[model samples]
Target chain A: MNDIVLNVSNIGKHFGGLQALENVNLQIEAGKTHAIIGPNGAGKSTLLNVCVGRIKPDTGSVKFLGDNLTGRKPHEINQLGVARVFQTPEIFPELTLLRNVMVPAFAKREGAFKLNAFRKVDNEAEVRDEAEHILEDVGLKEQMNGLAGSLSRGDKRRLELAMCLIQHPKLLLLDEPTAGMSRHDTNRTIDLLRLIKERGMTKVIIEHDMHVVFSLADHISVLAQGQIIVEGSPDMVRGNARVQEAYLGGAHV
Target chain B: MAQLWHRNDLLLMGVFTLAVLAMPLWLAPFGAGYPDLLQKLAIYGIFAIGFNILFGLTGYLSFGHAAFLGVGSYAAVWSFKLFTMNVLPAVLFGTLLAGVFAALIGFISLRRSGIYFSILTLAFAQMSYNLAYSVLTPITNGETGLQLTQSDPRIIDRLYVEATSGLPSTELFGLKMSGYPGFYFCAAILIIAFFFSVRIFNSPFGVKLLAIKSNQTRMGYTGYNTRPYLLVAFVISGMYAGLAGSLLAVTDPLAGAERMQWTASGEVVLMTILGGAGTLIGPLLGAGLIKYFENVFSAYNEAVLHQIFAMLPDWLQSAMVFVVNPFVGEGWHLTLGALFVLIVIFLPGGIMEGIRRLSSLVRRIIARSRRDGLQAA
Candidate 1:
């Protein structure tokens, strides 16, 4: 569909004798937060990895905005407006928070890679202003000069979110963003995700936290044993008998 | 104000330049012998600085930087022999050729990072050495080495004298030195190279290089194609090595395949690490220390040792000679190896780190003294 930002069809990934992921199908629209919830070792990360072109599926197709993303390199996939945040906050640790955000801004502004050596970065006033705005959005304006490595965990995740969002990607894939956050920080993250969605960006969050999934997910897909057990609206998935049996520890629905 | 100065990479560079220029004067008590050592130190300093940019900042340890340096020297020598005898063309050609060589190597080496990158560069450098030694005999002049002929047909030399009278004993702009002008010329070029390095280090590109080193995978996911950034950095560093190579030929005007050898590449790595891998001034300090051992340590002979040892009893002197023997005598490599091990074990940050720590201590003392003075006032 024209509004579909990402479409994964019958994707499967296998590593020798072990199956990492099995027949999975997912569809994300242009401006929605789609959460994939699964228990430990449920292939939520592998699915996200496949979406971001970090790993190739043994069989299947990943389509983003009508283009096949299956064989493309991660950077190439990113250039096509798919930004991913790692399970761990992956940022240039030694660089300042401002510079970390600037990396994506540079890529987006100067298509692919550029050798813009002689031009001063400050001379590009627009990009710098936009980067500052991004930092402001992520609540890191005060710590712009602070090294990325020195930031607290929540701030690092926020900084990374800013980095991905600054690129203005059509789709953002987040892997366990609130995995290690405290309840306060997790709620703060849910609020951030709400703000991003409210601003009209599509996101796919692979989260183990059921509260986060139930609260933030517009559409929830429950994964089990490397395959999609069920996908429906958050309340429907939360109420599904099979989802309860497979993922919700067979709890009463 | 002091904090601002320290934060400003350019200001630090200017201070470094002033210190480097004034180095010979500070060691003037050691006289002409020391200036030559200082010159060698500065030359290798530039070499190590370039190598450090590629390896230290980018974390792409290259075991083949000598190939670029050696080729750069060859380019400079060729420029001197065929075109202008002036150092400018030679240095330019040398550095540009190094960049070109780096582009080719980087294209392939960038395909694989980590250990594979190191092995690829090493293999390529070895290939360059072999080509220089044998197949490229016409250009590199084979085993005998590429040097300037007394009957060189260069236009810059022709402009100074009648074309009929020929090369005019290789005087630089009519100020004849027993090659002292050549040495000074090299020093000036090194100064320029150092300045260039400072500009680059402070640039956005330099920051990106550091980022690439930190997490290339993250960079890639962040919509950055890190390969191009890495390639550009590789080329820039290669050009710096080229400039150093050109300066080497300007001082002595001889380029040999030995300069491209794996051991030579290994030396630059040692220099950079010994000085301080990531810090700006570390490579220069490391290069200076290693080159000092190569030149000054090798200069000490049995007669000089005897002259110093004569004050002691004959038996005791013999024992002293034996004790001081390996480091002072023919075992200069042993001294270098020992120095390397000592630096690695104790001062891994190299001489630059040692200096930084010393300066910090001084600063702390100054701050305490100021506090005391303020209370008294």
Candidate 2:
């Protein structure tokens, strides 16, 4: 069995009376893609946010490589080789695509803070080349000089993925990587994930698209109303009765 | 081989040196060659440039920067009273003190951003102004301001050498800080400050600042501790204002409570926005233009306006003066307000953006003409 890269135990979060996440326990193994599939308002985003330190859970602990990640700032968690791709592609809009990628590259390379005022950013040839390489890998090399804000929605999503990928995180957390894309774009994204999977990077993807879930997930967890109904392989998840009643049944009805 | 002067640092230094060295010759045409106006230009230019680092780059608009300037002035004046009349110690003390003060204010104020941040700074500045005017009268001398007196012990000058003058003037190794020499001294320091600003603009630190401006939430998630970065910027800018304040005292030798007023802070903000906040040369141009109008244009009364149009018929000249009356002399502020409105309406990017648009338009016209000529041939 592969070593577990991320482990979450007794994670529970509440907003007033609504339970966002309740008694959530998850263990993601290294070099595997785990997909969390749930209906609308099913606490997928809340779980992801908790894992990435965006929100503090009411009770629980998140451990990555034996280090506790509870109550840490988002940036502090990011420094520990856990990169997150936002649902809407949170990127530096005014900056060029090359610079958008380079910001994370600088953060990953230089740690949290460095007073490099006198030194020119362009002088860091290695960082620039690495940024360029990532852009090329993501097929955004031609538009590297273009402003990130001006890119189409599909390209913006791709650029954001490239930014997270450049950090070479031990574990990547993608929150609805293809949230608002056409079928063509979704297919492209699925292909991209398959390509990323070959590199042996562990990823936890929170997606609602069943096609994407079945295509990429080595292990699928079907969540509904703040709790996972079933955890199994894609074939097993497709055949589970509780998951059908809670998720697939509701979708059809 | 690449030319040594082609490097950005060297080029910037060369241009700044040329501008400062030629200030006397060029400024003479505007009747502003006198040391007083020239010194004010350099001092305010430093103030605006420092303000730009925080407001322009980081989008953290500070409304209390003048408080630092006032603090700096007080520190310099105290330095003069306790130490020698040399400007070095005064400048150092002013800058360091302002930095400390800025760190304290910035630590608390940066907790909130946008208008809340601005209000916090404004409140702190008002409190300081009030304290300086009333409760801190012993240190600040109240409304009278702090000035050097003969009775004050100049321990350094007295211990080292004999006193020759009735009242000592601010100096650098016996070079008096007055007239053309004083202007040159301030101009030299302004050049150094400008160079540092340019370096910061091109650095990785600058990119991070722009990122903070873009999205603070995303910046935090990207593994950047933005608070320290912001605080450092705030302190650096405050030090710049302090440096400017020290220069003001170095030349004139007075530290007044009124200097810390909100209007003084507003003036720097005006200078930055009027010129182009983020651009390198914008703040300097804004400072120079505002000072020029305040000093020169305000001096043009109705008599001077009438004299300029003396060749025209009596009725025509009176008509011209009547039309121009509200824009000059005591009404110069009206002209400034009108210009600001026009710029905001048409060129929201300020004077620098206007220049960019004009140049691009010119380029387009030239390119089209060239294309037509080629087609005709």
Best by DockQ: 2
Docking class of 1: medium
Over 4 Å off, model 1:
A120-144, A150-155, A250-253, B1-10, B30-35, B150-180, B309-316, B365-377
Docking class of 2: medium
Query: Roughly what TM-score does model 2 have, to 2 decimal places?
Result: 0.96
Interface RMSD of each: 3.1, 2.0
Retained native contacts per candidate, as fractions? 0.57, 0.65
- Candidate 2 Cα errors over 4 Å, as ranges: A249-253, B1-6
> What do the candidate models score in CA lDDT, each in turn?
0.82, 0.90
TM-score of each: 0.90, 0.96
- Writing each residue's lDDT as its tens digit, candidate 1 over B1-377 gives 43454467566666776776677676566443454566677778888878877887789999899999998999989888887666777778999999999999999998999999999999999999999989999999999999888666786666665555334333355554234455565566677777766656655667667788888888878767788888887888888889889877876788999999999999999989888987777888788777777766787887778779999999998888787778865788899899889878988778877888899999999999999999999
Q: For model 1 chain B, where is the 10-residue window of minimal lDDT?
A: B164-173
Q: Model 1: iRMSD?
A: 3.1
- lDDT string for model 2 (B130-212, tens) is 99999999999999999998887878888987777577899999999999899999999999999899889878899889888
For model 2, the TM-score of its B chain against the native B chain is 0.96
Each prediction's DockQ against the real complex: 0.51, 0.63
